[model samples]
Target chain A: MSKFLLATLLLHIPLYIYPILRLCYWAESPLWLTLLIFIPLVSSQYMSRFYLRKKNSVWTKLLRRFADFYLGVSPVLLISTLLAEIFVGFHMVTFGTAVTSVIAITVILGIVATMAALSPMVKTITLSSGKLTAPVRFVQITDVHIGSRKPAFLDRVVHIVNELKPDFLCITGDLIDGQGVSEDDLKSFKSVVGPIYFTIGNHEKYEGVEAIARRLENLGVKVLRNAETHFTKELQVIGIDDMDDANQVAVQLEKQTLDKDAFVLLLYHRPRGLKAAADAGVDLMLSGHTHNGQIMPFNLVVNRVFDMIKGLYEHAETKLYVSQGTGTWGPIMRLGTRSEITLFEISPAQESLFPSR
Target chain B: MSWLDEGADVRSTSLTEEFTIDLYRETYQDRFIPLFVVESSGRLRVVTDKADIPADCKIISLIKSDNI
Candidate 1:
């Protein structure tokens, strides 16, 4: 067996098989009925893993969607079952009540979680910029995962961002994760008002970045590949490619001779290198990719992975804001987090005037 | 395969800590699922974990030294 399958199997013994055994015991099911449940339960993981990796047909896509939705619902089911089991253990509920309650709780919470994933809220962040004479407004939407998310979702994001009327849009990374997602699927990006600047995420690398970047460029996105551009006389925007290295922010910043007079705005995909950006005199950095754990206990895991998962973090002179992302990745549900489109309104700082003058 | 990617990939190794198992799809090379988003902060605050952060930030991780 592949390592992934093996690892998945080991994990599922505790996560899936144990839960099934408990449920079967609670209901006193026949061996055949137990087998029926086991087959589909065991197969869901492998089916999703194998089907959605490289290419996709209409059926594979449908299967992927089912698996994705199940992915979201499974967590809810597990948690509900866990809660019911706890109640039963405490003698507060009977096994039959526990089972029914688990189903009811899963259905309700599952729907709620799915709704949370479907809706993307507009989050406004205001900061004091050191270089700008006026407030610069821009919207940031990252990890949209256009593959799992349809283009209509992008259309909704664009419509919302356009309503905000920001100066420009910034996409940090993970814009596409599916090979099946085509350029036409991403046509709504052109409808977003103002310029859209992007850096490739890890998912982009997986989905053939060269092709994805080209598609984004065709749709009028400025794909910044370890590159920089002058947004205005007082603002310099630097885009760093999401390198598979620890000090991507530091290494990329070292290569750029930032304009002393302009506010240095850095767009990186992952949240790291804050001290590096600050040491290099970066004024502000924007990022996404953590998705703030994208779920409940998973957030706990993500917390272990990233130092700054969400919101603003300041280090010396640099400030970083990590977006919660604008779209869902899998299962199309958020247990403890909401999807967001971040709008940043940066006004000039009085302290910044001293250096510029 | 996910473990290999996480163990070997410099990015994954550096980005995450040990014992972090992924339950969701990664979709890199036909990987599994990724779901949920636990939002943080009470408004757009300057949340800090400066005390918990390690001092020496530049830790270069390679899965295997000989792999090209």
Candidate 2:
């Protein structure tokens, strides 16, 4: 049992410890209190089982599950605690001061989680039609992980998209966990929306990029694969595959005869190198790999990972819009960040409908 | 009256022959539906709404509702 406990501890530690330590830093707290809090939190599971011996009600059953699960969360807490200890100790900090630091870290994490849950997140961005008389309307929906265990989530999302009635829809990637998706699941995706345009994300690449691309194409989705399409006389849309294939993106761009005034949009799944995209003279870029750090403390860790994590950013003349994604990854619960569908009306500043105008 | 008089009171002249045929076909669906028109008679006024329509013929206002 002890060996099993040690193995379990080792297994779960990395998942929680690295993220908490990297992202959180508490301003003020006593080290002893932080360590003491973990003791009760860890034992809460056993205590709840003991308490359940005397009760037989729905509330008792629910409380027991909560206790078991939350107590299970102690492994994560333990990892985070040890990380705080190691960091402060390495800096030659006193043992008593270490507990304060850990407590402060937890408080900061709690605050971040709370702030994320409370933030007025963007729910749906709709592009009202007739606003622009452009021949082709390209709508980009990025980071929709539809394989979440969450119920009726995709149905509601598709309903929203149908209401908008865009002429063409583009999916920037991370369609599924890739691990969980089956052949039949991919088939169901075909009926979810009208014709779709897709580009693979790192997750898709992980699950055999070529196979996923071929399967999606078979379902009527055009996989851009560093390809360019002259969507309209005034616009040229290019999909610079994912980050790993940056060279392919450059090669494809070289083949296209890009006009200075043409509306150019690039869908690169990861937001790693915005400079390359800007240098490539991409007018607008769409990406959604970050999920903006799906969890609470993870958001801060993710914030540090990339320059443009979420929202519309202007770099010189290029506009980069990183959506938070339309679906949750694991646990089927989005504590901090809400899923989003971003719609943009790409038009010139003036009323010149014709490119010549 | 010349052959031009037959369509002189038409409100608008559709450039395409297909569109003109379709418009006339649409009138057959509902006989009560009005089709009043006033075409250009060498600077002649174009009767568009029911108010300017000749009482003998039914008049259909292009404005279905003022809210639109």
Candidate 3:
């Protein structure tokens, strides 16, 4: 196994196993019970990936759901158990009581986190520019990860965006996670009014870029591959493909010209290249690949990589907005973070000197 | 002062607008620099580069008498 994979397994296996071992020991269960729990704990991650790839049979669906639920609840259980261990170490509680409290807290927090994941909140932001001659409204949904989330979730998302009545829509990337995404999965997008523009995410490349591009295009979503389109004289939209290379954005920007006078909105998959964009005279940049760590503590790690994790940040003359993703990537659980749909309203800055004219 | 052929060689290709603009910039080199582009309706504007030209607009190649 790769070093990263090995490290993940080493870290996660202990987290999963220790909690169950503690609870079982406190309950005076047989030693064999620890082995039983340990076996599944080690195998669950791989098993979940396997079941997720299977055809949509009832058995596979149920197994996948169970695996995902276990993955989601495991972190909470592990943390609670760790806390219980600390309490035991400090002589604050008996081992049996510590185990009971840990279980109860884990169960309650798990339910709350799962519910939060199911319902994504809408975040509205208004941006005004003196350069803008006209007002434009855009609804941005990123990291929807459609294959992991069923089409029903997309249907609800589309309804929400439609209700917002945006002038246009932008999907910043990770729209689909798996290769199994079909045209049928994207049928709901047809109901959304106005044009929809999409840029590739890292996940799309994994799922097969060519196929995803064709599928999104057939669904009436314009795929912006380091290209741009004009919405009006006052506004222009540009999109750059996601690249692993650090200099890719600078290279891509060199190939394209930006409207220095118009309000330029850039749809890049990640929040990088702020200086390059500002130098090229881009007004606003929107991205969603970070997912703002998707869960707690992970956010701390994610913050180390990305300075602008979620929400609006100003870089020189350019404004960057990173969404916390529109859908869950795995486990379908959100803790200490929210799934969000960002609504942006851009308008011309008022130049009137006197008020109440 | 004789004006260079205003028409020149206007070529078309089946490429994205950005790539096409990049191609024009490469083909013309510095002569392509500081060109004024007009919208489809013929309204002129100064843009940062050729890529800023609207997809439907026409690129008008202008050269200074002493420079080009």
Candidate 4:
């Protein structure tokens, strides 16, 4: 097995086993019942990863749903059971009461988190640059993961974006997770009033970049593959394909002829290379791959991987805005983080060669 | 509107209608058509022959034309 797969199994197996064992011990479940619950939980984690490749198969679909549900509820189960054990050790509650309390809390919190994941919040920010000639409004939605999420979710997202009446729409990346994403899944994008631009993410590469790019282009989205398009006389939009290498952004920027006098907006999938963007004379960079870890505590780990986790940061002349993400990735659960669609209002800085009349 | 052959010498004659059409079709493709071609000398013209294209002039993309 590969190192990543091996590590995933090693880490997740224990996570799956511990909760069931503890829950069984507290509830005094029979050995057969314990075995029954344990087998599927452990196997599902591994099976889900592979079977998901057969996206449209009924068995794969069922397994994905089961695995997603298990993952969504597992964190709650594990944390609550741990707390229950601690409470029991402290003699604050009996074993039976502790297990019951944990179960109740997990169920309630799981439902709340699921609901939170369904509806995304919109975050609006305004930026001003001396190079801009006029105010521009745009909406950015990233990591919608349309294959994992149904078209209804995308419909709601599209509705919200159109309501904002943005000058244009940008999708940073990870728009779809599974292969064979149907036209129906992307049909709503055609209804969006403004032009839509997209840059590939790691997920798109996984699902097949050519397929996703073709589908998106057919839907009227301009897929920027290490290329650029002019938005206005004073503004230009550039995008590059996502790469694992840390210096990918810098390398890609070197190829472009950046206009120093115009406002240059970059759509990169990952939030890296702030210095390179600044050096390239890019005015703003929009990204959303981190998902801000998608769940709590995981965010801490994500923070270690990325220098900027969520929100906006300025480096020299370039500004970077990282969205938490518009949708969930693995499990449809969110804690201590929000799913967001970002709206940006950009205007020219108040300075002019000509005096006011 | 007239068209200059692809091989026509641009240095001597003004930009031909054919040259402009080919430039729009080839450079911008079917998606983007320049509404206003601005020359580097700060001179703006709706239509110009190849000879009129300033030596320092650069083609910048404007909004997508509905007709295209």
Candidate 5:
């Protein structure tokens, strides 16, 4: 067996088995009957992920959603099964009691995580810059993963952005993951009030960058490709294409004829470009790739992986803001982390009533 | 996984657009997804369909596992 399939079987088999065993104990049921019921439930994730997934196919959507949802709440189910097994094994509780308790815990935790995923919270950050003559408000939405998301979701996001009435909108990266949805679905942005700017994401490249960019540009989005444009005489907007290189920001910035006098706002997809942006004298940098891990323990893992996983960080004069993403990626669930849309209010020193305040 | 794709730099070319996943099943003897390397940018992807592989992408190595 390839290491991947073998590893998958080894991991999923145990994760699925315990939950079934717990349910069997709860009903005092035969193993065969429970297996019949739970096998399809637990196995759908693997079936859809490994075998096939077509975005437009009904069967594919159902199977993928089933699996993706399981992928999200499986952690809760597994942990509950473990605790239930321990409780019954130690004779701390009756099998029925242990099983019932586990079910309750899993259901509650699952709902909480699901709710967190569904709701996108607005995070506001204000910055004071002496260079700006007036206040500018911008809303950032990233990692919406449109194929995994429906058009309704985008409509709601656009509605919220319109309500916020930002001067402009910035989509850092990962706007569209798969090609299932087309320009018709993304037409929700037509209702939006201001100019939209975007940078290339890894997924956009994976699906095909030229096509995605062309579609966005046709919709009047400024698809910046290692390119820059002036938002104002004092503020410049630059978007460097998403790359796996550590020095991507530095290398791309080196090529740009930077207006050193302008307050530079650089947009790159990943959170790895702070030092380089700072060195290039960028005042602000925006990114969204980590998704704040999208789940509980994974957030801890994401922290170890990226020096700056989520939220804002300052390196020298440059301030970098890494969003938690406006949508879930794989599992469509969030635990301990909320889906986010960030709003930035860049104000001139003159506008501030109290400079320190 | 994008980060993991940083250094692999493999892109292969196929003569025809008719290249399908069955072609992969024929050679790799595996039922799982296959890799596509974009010839232009040298980007590697774990894609499902032949159509998912860009026109310029090349098929590189295929990894196989026992049927589960």
Candidate 6:
């Protein structure tokens, strides 16, 4: 009620004034610029409260503090921007021509800042980099939770995946929200024509592993139920079912004819057993249980748990890249984090062993 | 357990939020079934009843089930 209004106003105010601020900054009008500073200053407290509600539990008091933090920063940013503009405008008003140039620079900086803050969900990631290696191009998309609110979203994603021209595709986990499992939605992956590999995340376990496994297999995806296989002569890819058992992975590795020198890629739903994978000598690992805090400030929560929270990292000579995910899980809005389609270009480490890319 | 990686030697804490009781009910009304639910205490349980609540765990969320 009161909270909702405050939240909506706080969220929408920035969205509303953004365009006006751009206009004022572009025109280099001091009066309009002055107005911009005041509006945010006055609304800052309300905005902070709004932000707090979204971050902490509705029942928690920390949310109120966050609101205060946001409001507190509003005046400072406005004053700084205003002061800088005044300094420039004073110098430019004397010259007249420099006003346009100053405004242009401000606009450019604003655009860059906005882009940085509102980063896009999709990303292109290279699995193996540097010189000398057989390159394997693959795309990994995790947490694609398609539902009524987000129907046909995969169609766009499929188009993007196809544009990348990946040799293979991997879905680490959470293909759907699990509640609304439909035949049409299940067949969405049919658009993915390449050798698609999958591993069950916690969500798949909710929908009946066997049923989901059969359905995915029907669509031509190789759903790995604690299984290992080789994609090429020099590459051995293993898909482990989601669990905490490191011994099971070791046992599975024992049965496989693993090429010690060849690249090994392991797909597990959660970001657990990273050290074990490194010890297992797995060349790479891909995971996506943490939606990287699908909403803003929540990612701070994710940062504390996983070493490689999102994006690429190296540990014990093994490269692990965690996807922020392609789809939103619960909330539709992603404030701080972007959904991603990670692309990996694998290249040979040594010329003698693997085939040329 | 669909989440824990017993195969690896290293283990880390779970990286997800608990499935709120409210969200679980909403998901059921919307007909979205949970694939699995792991409690905060590390108890892993799969959903056997379609009409039942989605996973009530604090550290995990649902990925899409392949079963249509």
Ranking by TM-score: 4, 3, 1, 5, 6, 2
What TM-score should be assigned to candidate 3? 0.81
Sum up the clashes in candidate 1: 12
Tens digit per residue, CA lDDT, model 3, A85-197: 88889999998898789878877887888898889899999999988877889999999998788889999999999999999899999999965778888888888777787
Residue-level lDDT tens digits of model 5 in A1-357: 999688767767666766766678677888788878688877776677666754458888887887787777777778788877788888999877877887788778878888888889999999988778889899999999887787788888888888899988999989888766688888877776666878878888778776776567556576666666676778788888888889888877765656788888888999997988898889999999999989877788788989998888999988999999998787778998989989999988665576784
- With a 3 Å backbone cut-off (N, CA, C), the pairs that clash in candidate 5 are A1-B66, A2-B65, B12-B58, B13-B58
DockQ of each candidate, alpha-carbon based = 0.02, 0.01, 0.03, 0.05, 0.02, 0.05
Selected candidate, larger lDDT, 3 vs 5 = 3
Writing each residue's lDDT as its tens digit, candidate 6 over B1-68 gives: 44212111111112222223453333223323344544546566676764454332321223322222
TM-score for chain B considered on its own, for each of the candidates: 0.17, 0.25, 0.43, 0.32, 0.32, 0.37
Q: Which whole-number lDDT from 0 to 100 does residue A356 have in model 2?
A: 79
lDDT of 2 by residue, A78-154 (tens): 55577766777688765446656655655555455434432223343322222234544456666666443222454
Candidate 1 runs further than 4 Å off: A1-7, A350-357, B1-68
Return the candidate ranking by lDDT, descending.
Answer: 4, 3, 5, 1, 6, 2
Off by over 4 Å in 2: A1-138, A148-152, A187-194, A245-252, A255-261, A351-357, B1-68
Candidate 4 lDDT tens digits, A87-157 = 99999998889878877887888778778889899999988988887899999999999878878999999
**Could you tell me the TM-score of chain A in candidate 6?**
0.62
lDDT of 6 at A37: 59
List pairs with backbone clashes in candidate 3: none
Candidate 5: CAPRI quality band: incorrect
Interface RMSD of 6: 12.1
Instruction: Tell me the TM-score of candidate 4's A chain.
Output: 0.95
Q: What CA RMSD would candidate 5 show? A: 12.7
- Clash count, predicted structure 5: 4
